[model samples]
Target: MRIRIVLTFILLATGLLGCTEQRATVAVPQTAQASFSWFEYQGSDPVFAEPLAPDQYQNPVVAGFFPDPSITRRGDDYYMAVSSFTYTPGVPILHSRDLVNWQLIGHALTRESQLDVSGARGSRGIFAPTLRYHDGVFYMITTLIDNGGNFFVTATDPAGPWSDPVWLPELDGIDPDIFFDDDGRVYIAHNGPPPGEPLYEGHRAIWLWEFDPKLQKVKASSGRIIVNGGVDLSKQPIWIEAPHLYKINDWYYLLCAEGGTADEHSEVVFRTRSLDQAFEPYEGNPILTQRDLDPSRPDPITTAGHADIVQTPDGEWWAIFLATRAYDQRFYNTGREAFLLPVSWQDDWPTILPAGETVTYRPVRPAGLDNHPVLEPLTGNFTWRDEFNQPALNFHWSLLRDFARQWLKIANDKLQVQPQAGRLSSLEPVSFIGRRQQHMHYRASTALTLSASGLSAGITALQSEAYHYYLGVRRSSNGTTIFLEQADGEGVDIIASEQLSVSGDTEIGLAIEGDKDKVRFFYQLDGETWLPLGGSFDGKLLSTQVAGGFVGTMLGLHSRLEKQDI
Candidate 1:
């Protein structure tokens, strides 16, 4: 059966236009910002249509800085894993059924012993991983940045109490994936530094070895070279990484991502009749590439590779892969997210997104399926506005580091944050905040009345340990004033600041509009017209390149000592 899919693109008005539509032109609301509440408030609700579920199929199904997706299917269930970079609780596991809707399951690695992520640089923590199920066990194999190696873990359930990582002593390089052959022998394939190349050359070539699940070691005699990036023209001499093996009928298929994972990144596939034989390239090797998509639309899916194939209970085949969506010219709020594409077998080879060049919209739902689950709403009436009367921290608030018992207190309808001496750049601050990067355009505002004399308090949009964009009200020697600061590679800079009247209590508002890359600071005198204190500060500080960390931007409040030596 032939299916024709039509995708319609809608551009929502940002702050540049007014708040309503008259006939043909739509006015962008002045208050529109980059928060979940702002998106819902502006009536820019997500639609629940099929190809892409309006509400659930947000641009990045997996938000934040997650990248290099590897998914596996068990019966009607789906599990996905991604490169966690420098985040503490690495290897996040997501569960889904329809591929479009996903829920965050428990993290696979929780302890520092399993993966020492402390001081790991941006884009350099846990690399690409493969999630697979063999027998009654779920297995994951990945690499650790700054640590010399690849490792594997197992759990009885995908939403797991995963085991401690078993380091593969002989295995080297990154982007490790596992394949359990039909004969019950498990094979591990990864992109390792090519042979005879300089030891400093971190570039990878595909290598395979027999992995023992019992001993959790790479058998020395079982190692062999599979493919090299320097030899193949289409594969390119760049870095060939994120390799996964699949077996269909009598053929073993090898899939790897090439071209450096930037704008030129692509998914390449090849197959071999025997597991040990040299692989033959696919006639139409690059099953997927975004180079053909309209360059004007911000090409939501960049670096689209690191894919894994799975078959549903109904025998429908699909591939889950990682793709990044750009929020602006250079920033991606959702990071690398999980995307699904339908797959077809043509002449004993696999084809992905066969209907067209790019996945403009959701593909046709597989036939004979009627029990698809309903997608959940990604937005709601939630923001930084809080009464502080609750006994516990709201679900929206998460500490920069792990949550400790002694860092916060709630009583007398007030939230008191204990002053800590450490700088915010060390991820040691006791501050906590909410994170939801669903919309490219929205706003977040909060009111805080200070009670301490020597403490500095303010709201901030944090990207990582060292990078942040903040518009905060603090008590200087001149009295309470509003200041906007941004952190680039060099460090934080006060881009704009203004002195405000001192009082027993004051109201400070901060709004960040993601699309326009602007932030506006406002203060209300006696609850009147919101006087704008600052306007349109650049948000380039939130980019991964400038920010130099693995986490996406999160909105939250913080307090620090007036002096570093405190």
Candidate 2:
């Protein structure tokens, strides 16, 4: 009788406890997409961390062509601006909360009324802009490469309806930086050829001047030579530009990026007690460098300079500098990306990476973190497939010239592209389908089924107007054949021609592989085994230095004919 009563009591208690445990263990599903994976060299299929994810690191967190980054923190918000370098809408403004994530809000220059960059080269647009917020107004100062010298623009909102450019008629130099002192005085620092000479022939010096905020100009009499490399060649005697000013405690610090922004680039820091005095070189100059990283591996981080310092909300200090990561050890993909380094105050000066090394692995997050923001992913996993219902082109696509509406349309879940009545060289032809190179060794394949009445439809690797590499099928006099062409700086011509028996409404796929020096081409018909078309092509034909445009070399799609039918 006692055992039977105990069994009923035990059964009821066990059922109640099981329900409680189930409720406690269950978790709500996350609404957002999957978190980005971090870059681990040891992982078998390593994935890159999100652009600015909360759980993982956000790298090059700022997107696009943000070269020569200048950042500042006001309260909880961070504002940054970068060199636009010949792009039409210039000096893009970005906002961020944590250093790892950023978003582009607006452009400082919209109308070309004040400055025109119609014919500017790739790296010759707006140079080194300094962003500052003071007295309820935000100020951005930069230099226009081809037009007026240094200019300033102001706005109340970080995402701006910015005021027109205030040209500083007296300031004459490039890579201009503005420093607003604690006492309400504004100073402009720049580099130029000595008073009556040119900068391209030889090296130059740094100049400082007091700027008038109301007049929107530099007081002509205020110009003075702060540092002259001609006086001491031991200062490296090379290009010393992008001077940034920061006041730490009682001393004023002037830091600059040295070298020609190539493999030999470095970061140099100097300081003084007064703005008028010559900056004393730091005993441990070049606090950060990658010159000695590896003897076998090409230095991964080249052009590591143009640093901007910001203090976090928790009182931690950090420096954001520009560095380039080469994808193929020859072709640069991360074109001047922003890298963050923690700074510590020692001996009344700022010390970064006290180990005197560059960080390749992601660092640990800062402490006292309750809430972290999620970062957007930069890589779009979509490939050559087109389900063309969207009204606009994808982010991966861009035209060589201004895009036209008539040449392309989307309907019936297919992208309909009409062949223009001109050659591929004509600007009006609108032969455009291009994507940025994400990896050097990866193969790019597209299945293009042409419905046009013409004989040419295929893919091409475009360098510029005079230099390109293309492998495509066309209806020649002999039959349909896949032709390979390479254009040096001289002219475009057939390199290796092979005749094929392929007919109408067929699928074409092309693959390009190799480093920047040598590119190989391959093709497959109807998803068959790929046949090697061309090997070890000269990569000089696809270089931005030789191409003369604001865009990098792009892999493009085209439909063309040698002569149009009457």
Candidate 3:
């Protein structure tokens, strides 16, 4: 909801809009500006809660497109990191005391020098990242799909200025995981091509290599194929990825995701007593999956796999994995989200979520721990707003590609963004910054003063490189106009347009109201009255299923210089 203010349009005289190679600060009306509302965003909506039990919590421990969750614990503190894929400052590092509650502390990849995602499309940059803490340093190893093959960064503190990529050009695979054995030996486990030619199309193998931490490279002579053709070669599982090694007692457990990370994704486990020997498949493989669950079940969580397990201080066990909640049996606009489930050992093998249970909306809290109040981002309900008063944007906010220095600035109690030379569809980084949608039904609005003569700026529900919806306020010879633009693979199309009376000191409000079915665009001169600018557009256009990507919808502010050269 917007604050209702009825004030005269007063154009403060300034040459802020026409300056080049410099920044111009503009003053906003005192009544029109308000401090940004603060709220903790979790999952697709505000976190779901039960009034009866304050200790109980919901699935999606970390929400909104946070996938391939890898967690580790240091004493009472717990840290989890997820794949950020093409977003700048990739691999979000979240911290928490209890696993149910989490907050974005920092990012492992902050500098552009650490990641090169020049022309990479959606879902093509970073894959699943394995976060491990060994000795006094935090290690994060991941695949830069199209950029470089594999690399790892290290830092003493989880919230870090992590070191640059120690590129493993010799490693030829994705979803890399690192293991530091007790005997001062380090190893890297990942899915790669078979020893020679594959028997079938998706016939991949899990390979292991001895890693030298001092040199930060793989030992060439120590390479070996651990698990070939997945669990059962006859059944032939596909895309064995996201491998993690764990040593318990005298057994080394290797867990990896198979069945292609789609609806059929499942976690399969293998164990071996020695690294030199091949790992044997567990009799009860696929310890976690929902594809075999009853289809008639309500709000089923599909695509459940890519799991990583962590033990609590109290000796309790838990598994953190990725799953997607489908709406109306088939539609799922919220991308894969992180889910937590308890793990119980039976006959030396781990079982997840019991025999017939899928992911629960509200699960029981871990035993023996005090019923502490729910924390931020997991506290469940509040509205989020940013005043942009701080020197830097919040850790949760990310740009499409590398951070552009000239794109945005904080000054004069307003977020000043210089219009960039490209549209949201272009591969180049534009003047856009956004957080994930995180909600099926919500309202996001921003107040902007379009000072430039030909500049247009507003909010967008960005789905991918070729698919998105733009609700922008434009200034031209015809005065201020609200335009609704849609960009599919075909091209950009203006679906609706409306003229506004406001001229200078253009305090126009633009909002995108979203529901499961559609998204509607609106504009307001006075915050009280909103005029619908475009017809309700189909929400499916932004879904991962329809958009064909590994990313979810991002709703945020964007600006463009209509005539600037790219």
lDDT, candidate 2, equals 0.60
**lDDT score at residue 351, model 3, on the 0-100 scale:** 76
Collision pairs in model 3: 37-385, 43-63, 44-438
| Cα-based RMSD of candidate 2 | 19.9
lDDT by candidate, in order shown: 0.61, 0.60, 0.76
For model 2, how does the per-residue alpha-carbon lDDT over 26-48 read when each residue is reduced to its tens digit? 12122111110110001010224
Question: For model 1, how does the per-residue alpha-carbon lDDT over 316-396 read when each residue is reduced to its tens digit?
Answer: 677777666564544665455566777888898887754237654344554444434433322221133456667865433
Counting clashing residue pairs in each candidate, in order, gives 10, 4, 3
- Against the correct fold, how does model 3 do in TM-score? 0.90
Instruction: Determine which window of 10 residues in candidate 3 has minimal summed lDDT.
Output: 3-12
Rank all candidate structures by their TM-score, best first, as comma-separated numbers: 3, 1, 2
Q: Residue-wise lDDT of candidate 3 within 328-409, one digit each (tens)?
A: 6656677788988889888777877554567887889877655444334633444667767678887768888765556576
lDDT of 3 at 375: 33
Determine which window of 10 residues in candidate 1 has minimal summed lDDT.
34-43
Better of 1 and 2 by lDDT: 1
